[model samples]
Target: MEDCGEHEGTSELKLGTTIIAVEFDGGVVMGSDSRVSAKEAVVNRVMNKLSQVHDKIYCALSGSAADAQTMAEIINYHLDVHSIEVGEDPLVHSAATLVKNMSYKYKEELSAHLIVGGWDRKAGGQVYATLNGILTRQPFAVGGSGSFYIYGYVDAEYKADMSREECQEFVINSLSLAMGRDGSSGGVAYLVTIDSETVEEKCILPAELPTFYDPDTIES
Candidate 1:
């Protein structure tokens, strides 16, 4: 995990993290690990990386914690104003664009990557990824240093026609895989599922995480 940037007011360097978002048949699933680190120390163990942009729209945050959170809050405010002006929920694309614009404008000062997804009247469900000013709509998206460990796994396992249950499982399994290998990602896994009618949030404790390998069989 590389040092991304300094934490809000401290000299500690905010480190790596893991965040993911996947679009399923009926909705979208987003998740992340709860661990927050600074340099070689764990500064926070219960941070919420999945933040709501609107009632149904959400974004998974990575990179500088303060920068990412501040950006999300700003986007949420803008979306709220837009929704009121239009008398309707903001579109997923519009929310993603706002994130992209902010990231691009502050590319020099901010180091954050966001995976935005949700369900709206126009788009039943959508997922978008924004980083370094580039915005892309994807069936699924993954970010952060822990993400480096699971690129092959994601590519091999992802399916465009996955059901809601399958997508949720996929997200949990992916997070567990990365957490197990990446020093910078661990603790409980937080998840959010957004559909047209409702938004559901869940958490998987470390003890409940799936075991990918037999600890007893590993070489000392």
Candidate 2:
């Protein structure tokens, strides 16, 4: 993956990019673009950045593919153990807290950014983000180099009361805009929505670019 930036006072390489999560009326939506880059070169075209930590909990990773993958596996393992011991699935916030605590342990050596979102029976839908070992719960979160483009679209278009379908469209549109403007972001976008009853995922291909119109070319 491309090195977008480095953490302060550390040589830990940060790579991969572009992850977004938003909470809507009835559920939460999270997604990421499929492109993986290294420096100026594209390394993989179909990388999956989103991971299902539990039946309803999902995490999106951005930075250091190895670290991200390892982190997800560790979190998932913990969640699984919790579920088996408690006789119930862990809450979304619990999962986020678990990740935050684990992240702190590797703060100096690992450069990884994560967006965790899910739906819980008692809490409804929730979203959280982590950066430089600091994790915060948010209404929405964006990470990676392409986040600069995503924030603009989200600021203007996102609505907290939107439905699942609307949120999906908004996420696809936001990712498309980012891919168009950010060289490090591209490929198909994958979305996951978690509600009280179920979790759903969809793949949205890049939208077709608008065709230019010329006033002088009119012909009846």
Tens digits of lDDT, candidate 2, 155-176 = 9988868888888777777777
lDDT of 1 by residue, 142-218 (tens): 99889999999999999989999999999999999999999999989999999978899998899998989877899
> Ten residues in a row with the worst lDDT in model 1?
1-10
Task: Give lDDT per model, in order.
Answer: 0.90, 0.81
For candidate 2, give the lDDT of residue 46.
Answer: 74
Cα deviation of 193 in candidate 1 (Å)?
A: 0.6
Q: How much lDDT does candidate 1 score?
A: 0.90
TM-score of each: 0.94, 0.87
Which pairs clash in model 2?
1-37, 2-37
lDDT over C-alpha atoms for residue 59 of model 1: 85
Error of 2 at 21 (Å): 0.7
